[model samples]
Target: MDKFFKLKENNTNMRTEIIAGITTFLTMAYIIAVNPDILSIAGMPKGALVTATCLTAGLTTIFMGLYANLPFGLASGMGLNAFFTFGVVIGLGVSWQTALTAVFIEGIIFIILSLTNVREAVVNTIPLNLKYAVTVGIGLFISFIGFVNSGVVIKNESTMVSMGNFTSPTVIIAAFGLFTMVVFYKRNIKGALLWGIAVSTIAAWIYAIIDPQGAAYYKIFLPEGVFKYESISSIAFKLDFSIFNDPSKIWTLVVVVFTFLFVDFFDTVGTLVGVASKANMIDKEGKVPGAGKALLVDAIGTTVGALLGVSTVTTYVESSAGVAEGGRTGLTSLVTGGLFLLAMFFAPLFVAIPGSATAPALIMVGFFMMENITKIDFSDFSEGIPAFLTIILMPLTYSIGDGLTIGVLSYVIIGLLVGVYDKGKKKVSNVMICLAFIFIIKLIVSGIG
Candidate 1:
């Protein structure tokens, strides 16, 4: 295992990798319940989606470990799944099968791009400062997710977001969990995040036993069964290609395909950059090692996920939890993927792990990722303003892709202004210029559509 994964070279051992894997799985296991619930809104079978989600995530994550040799986990993306159901299927009046087809097409295009080095070129072209900003942005984005998940932050009409009731059991549990993590982390305990999650879960279970009705109200409780499995036959291989035959729907199909392509492409890039930056996986030249293979695996994961009846599968930002736990090799991904496979039969148990339980791990990992923010040079406005926007907009906009889009666009525009005002002072790369134009077109088309 060490020979293959180079554990010693990466300064990580099997035990650390295993704990990291478990930590990553715990942080992201919410998708087992959430993805199915969201996609079922588009009339897909919830049971079938549960199975397909696990299957796709398991297979693709394992593939990532063996092929790309990265510790990142791949799963049906949260935003993309919501877009598949609400944006394309309901709002655009496209069939679920057709939406899946669009996803499949996007995957094919991504595969081609990955193969031709287009994706790698883009990754290498991103400035180092912006890359650090992405890491910090994702850190804040993840922390926000943790806060919302734990009910520490609640939606409000007047203020947009407000504090939740401290009296809420979920909030109490999350606070205890966060406190536990902080203490363990301060003591330099191994698997502190994992311990935090375990403690939170136990506390939640205790609360459930004491007050079953209240526990159920907050959606916190024990699993109903030890073994449960759903077959994916109902939803698998259900892609609809009829959109190609209908001339009237061709424009809609094109739009849907472009949207999927655009979001998945940049979301994957931003995630890879953010998590890799946190892991120190990027080289001194600001290029991610084995990036081509990683991108390829991500593309293939999406394709296979579509075939298995799910949304686009991309490298997960939650993998940062594992990296924070000392995971540095594909061994972490291997263990994580194995857990995902196990989750297929143990669905109820994994799903019963309340979001509040995992929220602490994410929150702590967010802090670890924020350590890179100081690396960005704020002295140069051409670099500083864009970096600031990238960092702030991620959590505010609640979309990594949108944050990167605006950041890159601003970077190019500002760089141009600086160059025009003081020649040779700032020079934007050709790639950045091209990307800025593309983003502008996308924004315009989205507005018109």
Candidate 2:
């Protein structure tokens, strides 16, 4: 195991990697329930989606470990699933089968791009500062997700969003978990986030047992039965390519495909870079080793996930928890993948873990990603302006693609202005500038559609 994962080479041991893997899995295992819950809203079979979610996450994450030798975990992403359910199925009035078809097609495109090295070229075209900003932006975006999930922040009529009732059981549990995590983190405890989650889960279970109306108040409770087998047959290989039968909806299909492609493209990029930065895997020139292979694994995950009836499968930001626990090699990913597979059998036990429990780990992971902000050069308006937009827009707009779009466009425009002013400075690449224009067109198309 040491030789295969180069444990000593990465300054880690088998034990640490194992702990990190379990820690990472504990932080993200909420998806076992959450993905099915969200996608079922789009008329998918809940039992089938639960199986698909676990299978995609396990198989693809294992591929990432063995092929790319990275510590990142792959799973059906949160926002993209919402887009599949709300944006495509309900908003655009597209069928769930058609949405899956779009996801499958998008994954195929990613594979083509990865194999041809086009994805790497796109990654290289992005300026280093912008890349760092992407990491920080995703951090803020993830923290916002944690807050929303814990109900610590809620929709408000007057202010758009305001603090929730602190006395609420779930909120109180989350607050306690966050406090425990912060204390452990300050003391440099390994698996601190994992410990925090366990503590919160226990507290919720206790509350459920003590209070007569506890189950009504808290989402987490002991399962009556732990073993319930689910089959993937209902939604397996069930994609409907018949959406193309309507030529009139061709533009809508185009817009939808572009939206999926663009979002997954950057989401994968942002996640990989953020985790890599934390792991010190990126070099001085901002190149990530074996990135193509890593991206190919992600592409395969998305493609197969759609075929199995789920949303886009991408690298999870929660992998930062593993990295935080000193996981540097693929062994961490291997352990995480194995745990995901194990979760398929013990689905009920995993589902009993509430959002309040996982929220603390996610929020702390966000804090870790925020360390990248120090790397940005704030004095340079050209870099700082775009970087700032990327950082803030992620949480405000609730869309990583939107934040990245504005960041890239701003970078291109600012670069050109700097070139004109400095006289000797080289101009920004025509390809990047053209790509920014295409994103503008995509936005306009989305608005019209």
Candidate 3:
């Protein structure tokens, strides 16, 4: 009996590493569903485009985890999607192809920044308080996503997206998912996200069967193939030579490229630090292992996504959900990546899981993000104001960049206002100053528009 027990314990220990990997991957798998829906509205075949989008995210996330050794996951970034879909494609009247072109260029710039370690320098320059604000702001932003996904908040012409109907499918499923997750959390059940996803996924599937024609439903996995990826046949992945062929106003491309790069820059850093905290992936120095490599892979992933005719690829903050599940190692990430790759075979199944089912996960993740609020220094108006702007603007405004801008500029301005300009955390660096100034100018331009 003793020998048998020893053998069983050894087997369990051996598999623990694998379990860790799977937990990591599962942490970010929600993106496999959400990214596609957000991206594939260009009148393309919804099924095919969603599959491709998932494939890209999965591959990028796996690469980040398995090869890069980062605990982050990749997906169609939220704000960048807004940039691609609304701002660039719709507002600027540019083609999605052009937007992809911009994503490609921006990725290349990121690689350059990573190589020169310019990104590291940029990260190091920020004061600790601002960093805390950004992290907390991101947390709030994440919670906002959760609330919206859960269908808790909704749009109103006058108030703009207040609480939604309690009986809504999104709300009900989200509520159920959140409940299940909370139960697991309270019980200290490991792999809570997996359980939450499983329960929600099953609920989603049952809903589909019952409704048959309803707008909300569930998904069941299956295998299919012959994936249709157009806009991928050509374009050998480089600067569009065609734009060069007609050297007229090619400089506009430069602006587009920079905008994409800027978004990726802040987004990746923010996600890394934020998710790391939730996952407990941070080290004594508050750094994660292979973060730099993860950033490099993520940049490469964005470049690849653009080439494959997708939007800006980025590290998802959603991985925090997995962290809540006790996903501790790269093994967890690899498992998630494998699942993503496997999801390609069963495309329709993923689509079937409604927003309501996953909505709870978002809320739960956001619940976790609020944990950082207590860390902010409330005594100093300089610290308090910037932190406050970050936390408030992130969710209310629904834009990470906007929150960051408000926070940074507020820090600079409020410091000046409070006569702490000299003593308060070194005056905003030149780059931050420039970014803030440009953002102000752009706000003016947007207002004029």
Candidate 4:
């Protein structure tokens, strides 16, 4: 195991990797319940989706470990799934089968891009400052997710977002967890994140026992049962290619495919760069090692996830929890993937680890990722402005892809101006110029549609 994963070389051991994997799984296990619930609203079976979600995540993550040798987890993406259901199915009045077909087609295009090195070239083209900004942006994005999940932050009528009631049990519990994590982390405790999650979950269960009504009101409760398994027979292999039959629907299909492609492409790229940056896996050239294989695995995960009845499967940002926990190799991914497989039978138990419990870890990881902000060359406005936009817009816009889009567009525009004005001040690559044009076209098309 050490030889294969190069444990000593990476300065990580099996125990640390194991804990990191468990931490990563705990942080993201919400998807097992959330995905099925969201997709079921689109008229799919919830039970079948639970099984498919686990199966796809487990297999894909394991493949990532073995093939890419990167400590990242792949699962059906949260935003992409919402888009599949709400944007495509409900808004466009398209059938669920057609949405899945679009995802599958998008996956095929991604696979081709990966194989042809188009995706790698794009990754290589991103400037180092922007890459650091992406890491910092993702840190804030995930931290915002933690705050919202723990009920520490609430939607406000007048202010847009406000603090939740301190009296709320969820808020109190998450605070306790955060406090615990801070103490342990200060002492250089190993598995501080895992410990925080465990402590908070225990506290929640105790609260549920003491005041069941309040617990239920706050959506905090013990597991209903153990050892439950759902079959994927109903939803697997369910893609419908009927959109190709009608000439009128073909245009809609094209639009749908493009949307999926654009979002997944950038989301994956941003995640890979951000998480890799945090892990110190990027080389001197600002290139992530084994990125090609990682992209291929992600593409394959999406294709297989579509066949197994889910949205686009991509590398998860929550994997940063593992990376922050000192996970440095594929071993972490293997352990994480193993837990996902185990979650199939123990779904209720795993799902019972409330979002509040994991919220602290994400918030802490966000703090860790913020260190990258210091690395950005903020003295240069040409670089500083774009980097600032990238960092601030991620959490504000609540979309990594959108933040990256605006950042890249601004970078290209600013660089072009600098080059023209100062003659030798800045040089924007042709790839970046083309990308800015593409982003403009995407925005225009989306608006027109």
Candidate 2 global lDDT? 0.86
Rank ordering of all candidates by lDDT, starting from the highest = 1, 4, 2, 3
Please give the CA lDDT of all the candidate structures.
0.93, 0.86, 0.65, 0.93
Positional deviation of 95 in candidate 2, in angstroms?
A: 3.1
lDDT of 4 by residue, 180-280 (tens): 98999899999999999999999999999999998888888899899999999888898999888899899989889998999999999999999999999
lDDT per residue as tens, model 1, 311-359: 9999999999999999888889999999999999999988989989999
Distance from true position, residue 300, model 2, in Å? 0.9
State each model's C-alpha RMSD to the native: 1.0, 1.9, 5.3, 1.0
Which one wins by lDDT: 1 or 3?
A: 1
Task: Evaluate residue 228 in candidate 3 and report its C-alpha lDDT on the 0 to 100 scale.
Answer: 34
Worst 10 residues of 3 by lDDT: 1-10
Candidate 2 similarity to native, TM-score = 0.94
Is 2 or 3 the stronger prediction by lDDT?
Answer: 2
Model 3 accuracy (lDDT, Cα) = 0.65
Give candidate 2 misplaced runs (Cα > 4 Å). Answer: none
**Candidate 4 TM-score to native:** 0.98
